[model samples]
Target: MKQSLLLITVVGLLLSSCSVSKSARGQRDLFSGTWSLDNISYENNSGNFKSVIFNDAEDICFEGSEWFFRDNNSTGRYTIAQSTLCNGGDRFFRWSVVEPSQNYSSQLQFKFIDENRKDISGGYGYRLNIVSLTEQAMTLKSNVSVDGQPVTIVYEFSKK
Candidate 1:
C-alpha cells in the first residue's frame, strides 16, 4: 500500500508540471490581438510619426503617417509564417524575434517593395528593432535612411 501511494503522488506531480507548461504556451499566444501606435520619438534625419494597428488575431493591418516628405502616409498588412512575420511577397520584408519578452530584441529586414503595384521592383532596403512586445502592445525602433540622410525613430504602440 505504501509503494502504491508513492507512485500515485509522483504521477500527480508530473501531471501538474505538464499543465503549467501548457499554460505558459497559452500566455505567449496572448499576443494575438489588435493594437495601435500611441507615441513616437525621432532623431537625426528622422522625425516623429504616428499610426494605428488593427490585428485580426492572424494578420496585422497598419495605417500610419511618417514624417518624410512625399511618403508620410502609409498602410500595410503582415502575416505570421512560422515564427517570422512577413509583409507582401517574399521580396517585401520579414522579421523574427530573438527572444520572447515584453522588452525583447528582434531583427527585421526590409525587402523593398514599390509604392505602386506597377513599380513593384523599385525600392530600398532597411532594418528595424522590435524593442518590446506584450499581449496589448509593442514598441519598435529603427534607423532608416530618408533620401541620403540616416535617422533614428522610436515607435510605441498600444492595444486598441
Candidate 2:
C-alpha cells in the first residue's frame, strides 16, 4: 500500500508540471500568425499624453501596425506603414510569454533585433501586462508614471 501511494503521488506531481507547461505553450500557440494593432487607449484620464511608447515609436505610429509571430522559433516582426509623419519600417524581435504567478500577471515580452536577428537593445526589452488574450483578440497594458501619477496604456490587437 505504501509503495502504491508513493507511485501515485509521483505521477500526480509529474502531470501537474506538464499541465503548467502545456498552458504556457498553448498561449504561445494562440499568438502565432499575424495580428494588427487596432486601437490604443489610456486607462487613467490624466489629460496628459505620451508622445512615444516603448521609447521606440510614436504612440500614433503603432496603431495599424502589422505584427507577425512565429511560435515555433519564438521570432516575430512588426511593420509600421510609411506615412508622411511616421518613418515606417520592419522591426525584428524575439518574443516570449511569461507565465503568471501569485504576485504577478502574465506578461508579453519582446526585445528588438536587427534584420540579421541580432539584439540591438544591449539586452533590454519591453514587458507589458497581458490584460486579456483570446484566439481573436488580445489586450496588453503598460503602466507608466506621468507627472508623478500612475498611467496605463492599453494596446488592443486583433488577429488577421
For candidate 1, write residues 22-115 as lDDT tens digits: 4334433433444455555667853544322211121222323211111112223233233343242212222122333475344333333434
Q: What is the Cα-based lDDT of residue 76 in candidate 2? A: 97
Please give the lDDT score at residue 130 for candidate 2: 86
Query: Distance (Å) between predicted and true CA of 25, model 2?
Result: 0.5
Relative to the true structure, candidate 2 reaches a TM of: 0.85
Which stretches of model 1 miss by more than 4 angstroms? Answer: 1-31, 44-104, 108-126, 145-150
Each candidate structure's TM-score, on Cα atoms with residue i matched to residue i, is: 0.37, 0.85
| Cα lDDT over the full model 2 | 0.89
What is the clash count for each candidate, in the order shown?
Answer: 1, 0
- Residue 100, model 1, lDDT: 38
Off by over 4 Å in 2: 1-20
lDDT of 2 at 47: 76
Model 1 residue 66 lDDT score: 18
> Cα RMSD for candidate 1?
13.6
